[model samples]
Target: MGPIGGKSKLKEAAVGFALGAVGGCILGATEDPVDKIVSVMTTSGSLKPVMDEVRAVGALGLGTLIGATALTTAMTSVIAGVILAAVVASMFVAMRSCTGSHEHSVGLWASAGFAGAIGTTLSGASFGIVVELIVKNYGMVGLLWALSFFTVLKPPLRFVFKVLWKQGEICCTPGSEVRSREREHIEITDWQQRQRVTLQIEQRILSLEKGGSTSGIEGRTMWATQQKEREELERRKLENEEAEMAQRSIQDWINTVMVKHVDFLAFSGIPMAIVAIVTSGFGLFGYGGHQSVFLVLLALVGLLGYFLLKSSDFKFWMLVGCMGMFAIFVIGMLTLHAGQVVVTTAVKMRAAGRNLSREQISTAMNYQSSLEAVKTAFFGAKLCQLGLGATVGGALVRRSAGDVKVIAGAASVAGSLLAGLEVLAPALGDGGTAGALLGVVGATGVSVGATAATAGRWSSWPGTLGTIGGLLIGALGMGKWHIVNIGLQLPVAYVFAMINPF
Candidate 1:
């Protein structure tokens, strides 16, 4: 849909605000240790000490391996970070894609879940093994392996998915397959582009009305369709046993993009930080020293957001820009806290007559907390972003309701404020307690009201309620007793993903 004629921007903003508040709650409920870990893994060093411990234990069995990964610097290099991110993202996509409504007892999408999980697990293991075998060196070997694996696996995975989906139609569900045709990638353009494209089409139609032979632009569109995409689509159909392939979903694309972005930020953070320092008058007035650094980083973040937007998809960019800022800020906070730890430890060592340097203390402390570092760096923003995206997605499902778009402007402001609170809640010392309450209650209330306000297939609200509870319970379990956040977060993400917001 074109941005101008659709729902008013106000309603959209309100939806985002509501979702952001829920996200704030999720952040508040989760342990701060997540942040602490991110601080430790900022460096480029390999996890030598952690690997040594792993090897000493003899074999990488499940329990021991899990503990080791949980306790160690499992992914310290850039390649390792990308690999780890990709594995989780791919697995997440698979898990969420399962449980679809096909004709069979089991659905095609659902059946493919295991294949995706297995593939991701093997990828994770291969990443670790390759890193270990290569001595965790920084080079193209790791990158090549990762790229090769991802590229090589797509066709087979698609084929498997097709087979499963076909069988699922026959075996699993009460009805025939129910695939949403809205699975295509969203493409929106500015008014100018829209008008130009319309003019082109209308002109061609006029020529056809006059019985003119198809020759110029009209022929090109037909020619290109025949020349490229049609053939490709047909081949893919043959391979996948389907009429079409869903374009990579927005959620999946963003997940994959962010990992690549982490690589960009790894190099960009320093130069950007330096610029912030100089521009802030050395923290004389602008943003509060560290905050100033992050503020400058936000500029870069926004730039990336603009690129990701890739066009005049204003609404998409707004949420994504905010998310980019959130990601950079979270990473920056970890780095700041790590600096404090290094200084504190060095000071303590000097007092104890050990005389350790700041560099050495920083390095040792970083090694000690590599687990959290990997967690925060690789996996943190993804969950929050997912939650936020899905929550705002409520408005999408309710778009057919009368006068809803008119509320988007006000909603945008509210959403922005809530988003601010979500991102800055940690600074208040209450771990975003207030924000969390608002998010949970607000999101719950919004979803309910939105469902009542609309008259279409808006069954997504019920699952969202469960998702809120999941966030709370999962965060509590993980924070209090060291339960895996994934146990809860994954299901929540699955719900988020399953909702065809468009």
Candidate 2:
């Protein structure tokens, strides 16, 4: 208060809110990695469970599919992301009152997210039907569907942000609305400061007329009080001007835009829809069954084509090279061992009175190789999820250790209760119903546990660890564990973290 701070109160609050928003996005985006979902689909070697609404949530599918994953993971992300985005948006709006048209309320974000969910779910189901009707197979057709989706949806959604949603005010720079607002803000503050001084003088006059205090306490006089009020007004007016001037620079624009572009969060639904569709289709069309060489080639073409169009980064080239080497390796193995593997595979099939086609035999062999690739993808996804979770969780823990601890404690209790109920009553096995419950228990539990652990808390570990044990034991008790097959190992590993770094 003695001297004007380098940064205004509003600017400091906006920066913290923006950073927190980023942390939230990171938390939501990576919690359930898309590639992990794909790898899970591929791991099963078949689609029976992947397509089932009940079984899909348990898929590495990352809640993109129609089943419990959507209800649990997807829903969690939506709520978490929106709440997080809203909190940041609210902070910005509250402090930088000139920012954007966004309402300073949680309901706005919740409503937008709700609308997005509706659109995504509808698109996912409809796209599946459309793809089935138009394409001979889920090869290039599915790829086209996904790309076209991004293209068609991205722009329109962005338009909504521009025209209807009225975002981007935070992005305003020298040539934009923010500058205009900043100038207006200065004028308003100047007027308000002068108004305060005027009001104080008026009050003093009224007090004198009413025979109020005059040098009655601590030897203070009306003149001294009037001068102090005038000085305070000048100080405030000066700080306001300095802040206004600083707001004109490029730095403020960058910071504001970073906070405001969250409007783009609207279109994330398109990707969610795509994930649901592709994951479900993969299971429905290509799981566990053998693929003809022609079909596999088409899939490869689709994958390569999509990558080339979608990304130009160095990572794209690295992906292409890696895929090329894997393809070559596969080809070499097939050329050498195809006969032997097919003979053995076909013999097993024949004993069950089924005749084998060379194509089906080839599909069987390829399935094994696909498993290896899927594992690599799964591992990568897990590592990324954990790292991002840790980073964000650490930040949250630092911000409010007590809140994170409470969250962790709540999650562990809920998870343990879930595990115990399922264990005691194996008959409660419902793929989606029970799986969703389990997913909620596990997802919420691990997410919070991650947060608390980053804060150096371990009290929640026992209950969280007990959750995995309870789920397995309960599912096994009723032989229902096999019904859900994203595999327990990864889910356990996902939240199985606790270490103290004093």
Q: Which candidate should be chosen as best, given TM-score against the real structure? A: 2
Tens digit per residue, CA lDDT, model 2, 27-96: 2332233333454345443322222221212122212222211222222232233334333443344345
lDDT score, residue 173, model 2? Answer: 29
Give per-residue CA lDDT, model 1, range 150-185, as digits (tens): 434533544554465446434532211222221221
lDDT of each: 0.37, 0.37
Model 2: how far residue 220 lies from native, Å = 6.1
Which regions in candidate 2 have their CA more than 4 angstroms from the true location?
Answer: 1-84, 91-152, 162-220, 227-502
TM-score of 2: 0.37
| Model 1 worst lDDT window (10 residues) | 55-64
- All candidates: TM-score: 0.34, 0.37
Clashes of each: 30, 6
| Deviation (Å) of 399 in candidate 2 | 8.2
